[model samples]
Target chain A: MVSVVPSLWGYAIAGYVMTAGAIGLYVVALHARARRARDRAAAIAGRRRTSTPP
Target chain B: MVSSLERVAGRITAPRGERILGWATLVAMAASAVMSLVVSPPDAQQGNAARLLYIHVPSAWLAYLSFAVVFVASIAYLATRRTRWDRLAAASAEVGVLFTALAIALGSLWGKPVWGTWWTWDPRITTTTILLLIYVGYLAVRRLSDSPARRARWAAVVGVVGFLDVPVSYLSVTWWRGLHQGTTIRLLGESTIAPIMQVALMTGVFAFTLLFLYLVTVRLRLGRLEDRAVAEALSPRLGQSAEALLEQEASARG
Candidate 1:
């Protein structure tokens, strides 16, 4: 008679996947936010430059 | 000494330095994944389910580290009223919340198999949940005041007070009966884990720490840029161009 033990690999895999996925999403969001802020600052500066008299 | 320290900080926070840190974090994370998933052996008792320990422990540890930084930064902000201290506290708290949530989620995943339940009102779990809520409230408090100084002051106070939960959460398992296990990696005494497992766990912690540093640096840079944009937008002059304003500001600093 063979004793059967349940395979527990799925839980481990799920945990790792969730950790990586959440961190990856956060990194992407941070990059997007930084890009938006940088662009806003640059655009404001450019507008000011073009509108002002030399 | 202060000038030298500032110079060191300037180099580390520079764009090039940030890029270097990012690449290094990527490499460290890759190595950690391999160590965690491939190199480490399965537990004799818990079997493959123990693998979750790698990520779970590191996420939890990083959460603790992040909040500790917030606690110190908040105190500094209250004492000195420095904007940079407030920025550091806010950045650290945001990252701490992310790791705290991740830790709880991963803990649930691990517990489902080992403890035979997905959710429980275990002492540790309860305290940790409350810890998360406190920081969430701290983040929410940042938006309450319109004045930046007022917001920072309020947030700093919350940051300092909310950190009291961290210790309670950590000690909950020992303080009361619970389904959760006690500390595995003991600082003073011998650890219960095997040598190979310890190596894998340490690798995970190192990689996660690097990732935490990288994220906070980027967040701090974003905070600076956002503040500058707001300041520029609010203080526009009729004749002066933004470039002229920037140049004048730079010369003034010089």
Candidate 2:
């Protein structure tokens, strides 16, 4: 008679997937935030340059 | 001394340097995943369920590292009253929170299979949850004041005080009888983990540390840019000259 060991691959896979997904999402969010900040800085700088007399 | 140190930091944190660091982080992460999933064999007892240890351990370790950084930076900010230190503390705290949450989630996933439950009131788990709440509160405190200096002061106080939970969470397993296992990679004595497993775990840790550094660098840059934008917006109303504002911004960026 063969003794069956329960497969835990599902839990392992879920853990790995969740870890990767969360990190990837954070990377995307950081990029979005940096882009927004860069754009805002540029917009403000442009306004200042335009308003300042040469 | 500070100016010189800031100059060095400014050079190292430049875009080109960041790109190199980013590529190195990606490579390290790939190697870590390969080692963790393929190279290392599964545990005799937990079998495949043990695989979660790679990411889970690193996430927890990185969370500890992040909070430690926040603690030191907060102290420096309070002592020197530097915005640079405050920004560093803020960035570290945010990343720490991410890793703390990741650790908890991954721990839950691991527990469900091995311990036959998704959640428990184990000392380590309970203390870790409290640790997470403390940092979350610290972040919330940052938004309480409109004045940057005031916000930093309040956040610094919380950052310093809240770090006391880190040691408590770390030693909770030994201090109390709990479902959580004791430390695996003992520094003073032989590690309980197999050699190959240790290698895989260390690789995961190194990769996560690199990722942490990259994230903090990017976040710091974002914080500087956001501050600059705010300064620019407020400059006209406050009668601050553009040259003076630019000088202040450059100093802060360092």
Candidate 3:
């Protein structure tokens, strides 16, 4: 029985790295966009409250 | 454990446990990486190149799952005119495209090493490419319209029509001879994959699914916030609150 030696490790590593990196970047982008949107919503709400006299 | 999880879920605000899900997804993805790259053995034929399967297969699964969510959500959106459903469809479409693109890239990477080419116009590959293009067009149609209701309607229609590609892509390998292989895991019976490879691949699927859920949730919340902000901006009344503007918009549309 012949053993199958590992080959194309570079391609495997590159593929995995690209997958992980892409996912990571997307996650980060989501968080950043969420935060910015939250701030904008708060600002909108705050401006409305300030303009409306109690 | 169930009770604790429920309590945590109840405590989280709109988008519900965004932090918890995000962290869980990260942990699951890390575990999957370890299992796939370190614990799994080389393939009998493809050697180390087979490791790409762990990521590629899972991504393809997620792409399908995400589009399925889009399809269901789009139908719900069209039927109900509810913002939540529209947001769900939009977020799912975005994430679905991302995963689909990743699957194509990983498949290309695997093909380059094993098939001695970066790409081929295989039936499965061509169908999957069409799938990606369809969703991208869905996203573009979403951006083309300014009115929320109009945009949602158009995108929903696209989502429903675009979903026809999913089954086509999935069955392409078997329906026609292609460079890609047929399904290894099936619903009716046991899988044909090696035990060790099966474990890693399943882990990848689980992790990628978690990540997809987290991403879509976050994207939905962002969409909601943006919608609210835009509503406020569009309101006729000076300094109108988002809630008030939303009411005004709804009434105007009605």
Candidate 4:
């Protein structure tokens, strides 16, 4: 069997996986930080409300 | 404001002598690249193809070394729970990944002519590829999680476990049938390569390592800046001018 098609496919897929993997990882990292920031903000607000004297 | 910023650049972190050394290394690395790529003898077997060995081998060495730093730093972060260690560990990982990619690609270039194939599952090549994947996953997991400490912990575990793969990759050809050439082990006077070759190879190694260090330092600085920017952007703090703007922007979000 010719190695041509499979080799090309391997290179193609590797290229995609490399890019998608990097971008997907970066986007996920950003969203995670955003979610964390939001959660942190909410927690601080909650703490403020509870701490405020009547 | 722009003039003020230009003045601020004069007061940046690095001391004068250290800055000079850094610049010296840049000059030295260029000189060594010439020595290795131009002055060094072509291998009787691979000719100029072997010239790539200078770049490929040192890069491979530094990648392993850098990741080893990440692994240790990650473990330290996990044990101490320090965010600085987390930053350093993350920085090393990104740099290690980039260098490792370079090594693998350069190796393939050498492999095409020497081995008659670009890759083989022979122990070294396979294990090295595995090492690359492990780091890729380390970076992936890091990217997937938001908490700096959490990402550091998970990546630490992966990095430590990843260490097992490195030596195996190093010894793979020695241990089994492989596409990689075994080290040219020799005894007594035969132990040394020709002086020119040794000079070329050693200079190449040092140059590449310097280049790698420069790259990693820059990457680490960028990562720290990015981390600081993101942290400041999200918080309501206003200690700095940037933070003040960030707070105002956050209010607009409200």
Q: Which candidate is the best by TM-score?
A: 2
Candidates' RMSD to native: 4.2, 3.4, 3.7, 11.2
Model 3 docking tier (incorrect/acceptable/medium/high): medium
Lowest summed lDDT over 10 consecutive residues: which window, candidate 3 chain B?
B6-15
DockQ of predicted model 4? 0.04
How many Å off is the CA of B139 in candidate 1? 1.1
For model 4, residues B1-254, the per-residue Cα lDDT tens digits are 63574254334323453356458666876777678656886665565666676667767887888888887777776676655556667767776787788678767766776677887677777788888898888889889766554566677888788888888887787789866777643434463366687777678678666655554544444554555556554555434443244334433433
| Residue range A2-35, candidate 2, lDDT tens digits | 4255668788889899988998999889879989
Return model 3's CA RMSD, one decimal.
Answer: 3.7
Give TM-scores for every candidate, taking all chains together and pairing residue i with residue i.
Answer: 0.91, 0.92, 0.90, 0.69
Model 2 in CAPRI terms: which quality?
A: medium
What are the per-residue Cα lDDT tens digits for candidate 1 across A1-54?
A: 542555689999999899989999999999899899989988877887787788
Clash statistics: count for each candidate: 0, 0, 0, 0
Write the residue-wise lDDT of candidate 3 on A1-54 in tens digits. 766665879999999889879988998898898888888877977887788778
Query: After superposing candidate 1, which stretches have Cα over 4 Å from the reference?
Result: A1-5, B1-6, B236-254
What shift in Å separates residue B25 of candidate 2 from its native position after superposition?
0.7
| Chain A accuracy of model 1 expressed as TM-score | 0.81
Query: Can you give the lDDT of residue B131 in candidate 3?
Result: 98
Residue-wise lDDT of candidate 1 within B1-254, one digit each (tens)?
A: 64686587678779999999999999999999899889998787787889999999999999999999999999987786767777889999999999999999999998988888889999999998998999999999998976677788899999999999999999998899998999888999999889999999999999999999899989988888777676567555754443344434433433
Against the true structure, candidate 4 reaches a TM-score of 0.69
